[model samples]
Target: MKEEHMAKDKPASGIPPGSWPVPLGLPLYVTVEQAAKLAGIGRDRMYEYVNSRADPIPQMRVGRAKTLIRTSAIPDYLRRRETA
Candidate 1:
């Protein structure tokens, strides 16, 4: 394929390379803020959901003050909710 004719494969996020902390393809893991952005919600809302018993966005408690969410969670949820 000609260089100019070929499409440049990029992550779906549309975020420039190196700007995002995790890979948009299949992130190994993500932080609260990252998860929030991926989930299309605000950071405070993400925290609220995480803290709620009926947690909509699940996260793993790391030690005392840290939390980590499976990077694929958002994508899987989105896939499930995608319109047929």
Candidate 2:
């Protein structure tokens, strides 16, 4: 399904699947795809980083339907990579 259409059917949380978790003015949490876009990475690579136990990026999941990554956490992950 197209990413935009992913949210056509609202989940139990009442929030759309692909929509941003935070309000318009605030940019705290974003969907993994959005995070990937911001970080200049592919969605698959972002998911791999999040799923990798060795150095997984922080994430929030809702019933396996929604997954969100903190925008702030991205920098921390990159910093760890730089140091290591």
Candidate 3:
């Protein structure tokens, strides 16, 4: 079907297509690039944080292949920055 092909054509971001219900809600976590876009910062900066041990925004490593940032952590980190 056309819908099936459309899903296949979309790039993979580790998550398998249709593995979960769409329109359910946004993901709890996101790739570093998505985090960067959400925070209006560069991807490089996000990567730096991921590498740094003292980073306020915590990152998760999945099987040594993918790095993700918690969606809730982004704003929390920014607030911490403001207070500090």
Candidate 4:
């Protein structure tokens, strides 16, 4: 069933199955801390991105008190940093 879903380009469950997805592909979801670490930014900065009402934001809310950042958004986040 998992392989079938993978073949169809769908996640194993309609709901994402883990704290983070394997293979590091697009539409990836991760916790705030994880996302921040991946983005190479401070936790507060990550929150800023999550809370910002601006364009090119990189954060998402998974559940109440549970926020996720998309892996696809990482490049853009890094690009926002001049040195990155």
Best model number under TM-score: 2
Q: Write the per-residue lDDT of candidate 4 for residues 1-84, one digit (tens) a residue.
A: 977768677565565655453444634677777778876789898777777766446666666778777776766666775562
lDDT of each: 0.70, 0.80, 0.76, 0.68
Model 1 residue 48 CA deviation (Å) reads 1.4
Where's the lowest-lDDT run of ten residues in candidate 2? Answer: 17-26
Q: TM-score, each model?
A: 0.52, 0.62, 0.61, 0.55
> Which of the predicted structures, 1 or 4, would earn the higher lDDT when compared with the native?
1
lDDT of 1 by residue, 57-80 (tens): 556788899988877666665465
Whichever of 1 and 3 has more lDDT, that candidate is: 3
- Stretches of candidate 4 off by over 4 Å are 1-27, 81-84
Across 1-84, the per-residue lDDT of candidate 2 in tens digits comes to 675575666665676655764446647888989999978889998989888989889888967689888887887786776753
Which has the greatest lDDT? Answer: 2
- Choose 2 or 3, whichever is better by lDDT: 2
Better of 3 and 4 by TM-score: 3
Worst 10 residues of 3 by lDDT: 15-24
Q: Give the clashing pairs for model 3.
A: none
